[model samples]
Target: MTQIQPASFRDAPFREAQFMPVTLDVERRNDGTVILRSRVELGEYEPNLAQAFTKTAERCGAKPALAVRNSDENWEYTSYADLKHSVDAATQWLIDNVPRGGVMVMMISNGLTAATMTFAAYAAGVILCPVSTTFGLTGGDHVRLRHVLAKTRPDVIVLESNPKLAAAVVSCAGDDVAIITTDTQTVNRRAFSLSSVLATTPTSAVVKAIANIDPENTVSYMLTSGSTGLPKIVPQSMAATAACGQQALVAIGRAADWGGVIVDWLPWHHAAGASVLRSTLLQGGTLYVDDGKPLPGLFDQTIRNLREIPIAYFSNVPLGYSMLVEAMEQDPLLRRTFFSKMRLMLYGGAGLQQHVFDRLQEFAVAETGYRIHMTTGYGMTETVTGCMVIHYPTEQVGIGLPTPGLEVKLVPQDARFAVRLRGPNVMRGYLDEPEKNMEVFDEEGFYRTGDLAVFSDANNPEKGLVFAGRQSEEFKLSNGTWVYGGSLRAALLEALDPLVSEVVLCDDDREFLTLLAWPTAHASDQPLGTIVNRLRDFNRTQQGASAIIRRVALLDQPPNVDAQEISDKGTINRRAVIDGRHEIVSRLYAAEPDDGIGIV
Candidate 1:
């Protein structure tokens, strides 16, 4: 065999080789699936979360891994040793409660039943179908529960021990699946309580689960309630979760008292908890659970928590940042307290506006005598959390390149072929939906990310990637000229400043592209004409026939909620907006000055 020497960049022969520039939204190809042949100790992995707790109990598992609100309103965390014993006892009780391998309807309040046992089941080696207790509150919730029951067909439905809530669960489950209650009491529901399960005979029944179960063992299933169509059951695996944990930890750097104290209230059913919690747990680190949302009334509490934690890394959807910027600009100690611990402040799960980034830069420099790293990460649940994370300095606004394990490909999308990615972090498939799964991954096995991106610094590929926009939303006019809604949106936002929080580009079949500008609710002081004039200025920056936006409206209505699928990250759901805006879009196409959008 021919001897091949190691590859090094220092060699002149490799100096000319081109690597993609890094940007906030861009993706780059870098080989494929990773195999750790060299035992370089990349780090520990709870490949099967089932065995993770046992491993942690032997190591740094908290005295109580499960947390609960005390009578005094303080949140207390449970240690690992006790949690393990509880899980084992619970497993033995559940086995006697329901048949082996039978599905269990897991739904209750946002407490332990929602967060812990649910996770415990996966670790305890049972199939747990997680559902929302909120589904029983509204007509929509009932309808959703019906849809879920038909699909999962669980042998047992577990309701939180709250008596009132247990009654709802029993009524929902009916005579079909047996109901098991936790801690709370429910009327008319014949069931076993988790507390009773914990007090099971033979307290040491041994809850140790088989760690090497088939990857597709169907541990946890989450339904996607996206606006577009019927919900999807996104089945999760040990591989994907473990992969996501490793990927995020490598990039974010995890260590106790070292990593950021993420004070987010994002739902655990989504990717945020999966990626964030998995990474933190793998490092035996701490995760501060926040109870508030990003809304105005809730902002102060979050700010207080944020100030106290000294976050090393923090992320919020764009709207959250817009508000954070306001609160940050108003306070001095908050800035000192914030930047004091915040090393990397990231934004994602939606499109980020430039003005928010600028405000962050101002706050960081003025208070800390340092610049905070403002960045964005892009990935789908299928892609194990995030495959690409751009940690560009506050000054740069682009999403950066992919980490070492991923690969990207961009085909024009228009007459100009654009870039995209194919990587291992990409999902295996959407549970049992082979037909749907085939479309997501190309023949080469790369996940077809619907996002469009450009080179942050094309001259040097390694610099990073920039988020261009949704490829599906980019279009052209009768002039045979292309309108990059994303590129143009970026330009308009840069010029419009912070007052204009979000913009939806219109005019699909019309002559010039239009906009439905959602001004910042706090930006009431800015006049409509000023924002319009700024749009005109932004349009002027474009050259040739592509420059457009004959009319613009500042919408009083916030972005669509259920009907319009604005991303959880706060990016405008272009397709949802265009679909729902049949009339609003019509007026914009007709150049109706009374656009659904308006200036502050």
Candidate 2:
């Protein structure tokens, strides 16, 4: 094992005394490149994912590491010792059943079995690939799943015992690859039970395999949903993933000695879930897998979990926090329990609205007697999880300074700057696509992030970068003003809170912005007259042409996965919105708009 270096928190990126006790060191090269790196040292380790779990297990021992609700709707706990034991057992099973250095594609949901299996694969040096369980045989999800299977060409696939997922994997895997299911009973004779594998005794061969594994080996092939094309497989090294975990711990200002708890439902298919799991495990913290999502009829499950367990750190998309705010308003007991032991509230995937941010702060202060620290970060699968995170309190939305190992360069494009990042956290390149890789990186090898951003304080890089929308999504109006879709969408979501669920900003060669919005489930109960009146009140405060919505078209159906409007991670694909629904957009500009189109 390599001796871990001590992190230097003295030179943190932000104003040291204002926020979390974390800092970074920024240096400028003579070649006009600025480099930002984390000052916090990651203490000694073997720089392997499996080694991380082994050390955490020894330290945490009998402490609870994971919690999941059983079929009976009760919490079942897994201690660190139990986790290590299970991982070892499962590791031996993989060694026996799978060829060395094979791919282990996971198609299971968030649970004890799924979590253990993923770690066990890493321990045995299998490349872990997780696919969203929501992906079906049809739609854009199917296209993504197929792309993943073709790229990784997995040696084995793990999934729930259900027929739906079984069929999906089988269709993608064909007859060559082995299928492992969680069911005890065999519905498909070819499918092996995951329990049978877990029952295998530990072998020295597995131990030897773990010792021989290389930190530079690709540990995972995380799929990224390209905004313009099919999902791309990111070959992530063991060292990169582990480094990301350390960065996460530093970004949150978490002490190794003070282990915390997290309640999360984000899918393992995405980088966010993997980052959270790795960070919690490395910090010896507990993770309670909440099955609830931000979508309608699902957030209640999250509320139920929160009502029972006190979370120290909370992470979610802006939409999830919005739903949570609505729930907290209705239930006083929930408000108290949710914020009882809260340390930090983190939002990602997109910029949060000012209204939603303010509401959460109010609730936290009322319940916890003070305003809790609310922060956000910016990164993608290419960066493992986050390259830049806000470590301190900010007045508005700004992704905080770069962590210890990353280098962020801002290249001028349009009115804003396109963010280019390079570090251990970033992937080496896209799998098997040399041309695509060339297009994404510059002459200096910084990965070109398609998104644009602006520094919050031009004089002070420590203040961080404000996300300016995706480059492809931005379009010019007839008046020649470029409208940033991401910022506009966030503003509309805030102003139309509790009424609009999602918004797609459409304008190119048009006089003003056209909003194609999906009403909240609650909005379905209100009359069209009521909905239009609410928009009228929201528009009254707006000043500029870029901010004004000349026509509002209420969508009868949500963005469809088949049409490519909804990505596999459930985020709206902005280009798909305009291209998929050209008819709806055209109607908004008709001489006499339809009843569904409200003229402002």
Candidate 3:
């Protein structure tokens, strides 16, 4: 067993930024329940998302509101004024067609048009439901798409002009639902062109619709990842969405200055991506909709985009940061362009490995003589994005304290605490699911997050909290030893660095633990003996049965997005993968293991 060194960022200069002062109000109940809230009052925020966009448009009409890569591989910019006009026209069309408060399902990818339609739908008082394009594009059966359609019962379905999507929509959507495409050519009888919608003359009705928007009214029906079961629809209100942005502002301050540039590829269907979109627009910043992703084939486009566009703020999942680190390590020009103007680097969706954080700091120090401030936040679809953030400067990874206007309740659960939240940003309940609503909230009206956390410094309440794992994912073995899946996964990832890209723990009700891992790209070139030796080293350091890995199997295939084994945000659906790949799990726990299984 070897001693692991603690991360030290003292020598590295942290990039300067305006962070709002944090003052937490902590209350310890007689029953050992702890309540945490920020004392710094949340200032005024926009009443509705429509008003926010309108205000930004008026403030910076000539500034680029959104940009997308054209077919020629050059960015096509859309000014705030131009986008406002388009949104007004689209709003007028929606007022004429769809009933007020009707749902409009968006199945389109991120682009200037998608951005326009999103705000237009908000301004027109139409509840927007943005779903993953993979639902319609991939998975031959379109099971999830049909399920979403059934749940939403949308009046209009808007998507990019693709024959496959058109066919899928026609098959799943009701005949009464109108289908809109970007192009003028319609593939189905009920289809309409986005061009026609945008060509509609803006009347006083559009202005009136925008003015009539209520902060309490539902703005969007955000869908959960459905990792454990079917995707649940979370109805986000205008006030909640706006409050999320204000929370970020008061907690971590602005990611960039006014009119700053942001390049991102996070899908708009997810809460984090939606927050990024809304926050950027509200702050009067330019958002360049990135077409690239963190996947192997698509990440190259991300590198290309970063090379061309100097971003003020960058955010991605841990895996995405891992890929970026590899790219930046190889290309000096890429590092220069990426770090030249980047004020902050934020990671979410998963725990970032300490090695990745260390390497990024080294690169940052080399590039600009200052380590870019890296932070993370904790939230979900129900919260309209991150309601808790790592606002202050610190080297360690943590979930941080609750943002202003949010209350966090921590109930004792073994050594950790089960997290529950109550905030203006938090959702009232899942859409029309009274049974689930009852189960999700407690008697005090706190939204039960089902997440486990421990204080970073129990003696100091301001140090924030560290995520332990999900309560549902924690399972007891046959021997009655509980395995904290989330914390264990994070630890194993750090221990097997540069070897495994991701790992899933198994043997929930069995005697011991096993792992199914996806190898890193470089790991494939390494000898099997080397990977086995690393696992043996990690196992030797563990003292308890819960922490020990008895065997490991390298997965040949990645988590399939079409099968719902992985989410658009790159989060692995642990239950989905385990259920979907029973055979693989069985092989890992066989009585007489094969040569491929690395026994420790």
Return the top candidate by lDDT. 3
Question: Model 3, residue 308: what's the lDDT?
Answer: 86
Candidate 2 error regions (>4 Å): 1-46, 137-141, 184-189, 255-258, 476-483, 494-499, 507-513, 520-548, 556-570, 576-583, 589-591
TM-score of each: 0.79, 0.88, 0.96
lDDT of 3 by residue, 469-490 (tens): 9887889999998898898898
Runs with alpha carbons beyond 4 Å of true place in candidate 1: 1-44, 61-73, 97-111, 128-149, 156-175, 178-194, 197-206, 223-227, 254-260, 391-394, 410-424, 475-483, 507-512, 543-547, 560-572, 575-600
- Per-model RMSD to reference: 8.7, 6.8, 2.9
Clash count list over all predictions: 58, 12, 0
lDDT of each: 0.60, 0.77, 0.86
User: Which candidate has the highest TM-score of all?
Assistant: 3
> Which lDDT tens digits does candidate 1 get at residues 130-247?
6655555433345666767777777877775555455455555647566666453454545566677668663333343444445446666666644345556766666666665665
> In angstroms, what RMSD does candidate 1 have relative to the true structure?
8.7
lDDT of 2 by residue, 39-59 (tens): 766544457778777888999
Query: Which residue runs does candidate 3 get wrong by more than 4 Å?
Result: 1-10, 183-186, 478-480, 521-525
Better of 1 and 3 by lDDT: 3
* Ordered list by lDDT, greatest first: 3, 2, 1
